[model samples]
Target: MTDPLAGRVLRGDRRAVARAITRVENGDDSTDLLNGIGKSLGRAFILGLTGPPGTGKSTLVDRIIAQYRGRKMKVGVIAVDPTSPITGGALLGDRVRMAQHTLDSGVFIRSMASRGWSGGLSGAVSEAIQILDAAGMEVVMIETVGIGQSDIEIMKIAHAVMVVTMPGLGDDVQVSKAGLMEIGDIYAVNKSDLPGADAMVVNLLSMVRDMKGRSPPVLKVSALKGEGVDRLFDAVEAIRGRFLSPAGEEMRLRSVRGMIVELAKKKLLSEFEGRAFARSVEVARKVADHKMSYEEAAERLVDG
Candidate 1:
């Protein structure tokens, strides 16, 4: 059966695209949608923005959207916000900064909760990207939740990852501590109007100078005042071809391999939660009563 929604998505029907993404988020069976949109996957350029909190990533994204729209291209944004542990919900407020684009059909913005999934991204992000790509979005941007040192999973998925940072955040020392300087393809010092912004840019450039074969650009921008955004946009747009080259093909292959491994892990985790949680209770009781060792209990859980 041909899924009608698939056709609508191909035609860039916003409602249908939104519905498809919702289905993906809910963990529904989306085989038909995936098959229908399979060939349309690589059309959009996927850009990821990640950094610590209070770096003005949301504001920068809003500016980027305007730049893309000025060129008459369709854009999609996936903003991942931290999940609320108490209610298992997200405030989903990244869109508030992007309110200007809310009514523009040329732009599609969706906020996803991290859902306690680590690495600063939810599991549904890749599928959601496909949905927007199939809907004729020429550029799709992923803004990850405020991240720390080990939350570098965006590198595996995005063609280019831009690390956003600003002044007043302890600058180079904090960046080195977080290990963010190495993962970025582009670096933007947002809020460059601030007092310490110039020093931050200089230090970042120095840090990235010995970055092996890559000399990633460290640009300064004030996303709030919209200063230097055009140069930043140009810097980001220029790197799109690097991922589409022969070497990029190799990179894409690795990305696919990683995706497959992640899928298998997720599947195993789902099954484990379903059957193993109940069995673990019995095992725990046995261990507590001194009838079994922790190592033995672990082996039994996996073997069973």
Candidate 2:
């Protein structure tokens, strides 16, 4: 029998969307669910926002929503917030600034707990984006769980990524240290009302100039004050167009190839563990004891 939930999701039913996301958060990998949403994916433009904690990424997301809504397009948001270790859940305050649209039928919002990912986002976010795209959202925005330099996996999920920064953080030198400069397609220097804002902008521009290829634009926006948001939205639209063009197909293919490798690795690990968990643990202990190399141990597991 066809799953009614899948039908509801494709029709853009909010409750069904919420229910489906809940399954994803709980680590559901049911074949039926994936098959249901498979063909309908990749229609919406995905915008990913990532930066250090306390940079007000959520506020910027709200601003993006308003811009898309102004054009009468349906919008979907996935706010990935840190999960509470004690409760394994999140307060989900990411939507507080967006409370005004709680009743809007054109907007759909879902908050997912990062589930102990200090820098790694919950693996379920990509699936969530696919659901929203299949549901016909014109634009889907993913606000990452506040991340630092080591977490760059968000790039694989979004067609265009916005790295939001602000004044009074460390020097622009921190951008490369944080590994952000290489991944950002667009940059927003939020909290532009604060001191050092212009310096921040110029620093970002100088950094971009040093890069080899396409220099991404960095705009200043006071996300708190809703200043310069229009310029940011326009940049996103322009970048979105570029992502859909033939020139950008290589980038898209690269992203897909990476995702495929990740999935295959996960599948291999699962099968390896099912048959050889005890053996793998023994090899791990040997490696830790400096008696065996990890490369040899990996070969053992794969060859076994």
Give me the candidate number with maximum TM-score. Answer: 1
Residue pairs in clash, model 2: none
Local accuracy of candidate 2 as per-residue lDDT tens digits, 142-223: 7764354224675666788898889988957566677788888898899899999899989989988898986999999987
lDDT of 1 at 48: 83
Report the lDDT tens digits of candidate 1 across residue range 69-90.
8999899988776742111112
lDDT of 1 at 186: 91
TM-score of each: 0.85, 0.83
As a whole number from 0 to 100, the lDDT of residue 116 in candidate 2 is 56
Provide the lDDT at 261 for model 1: 57
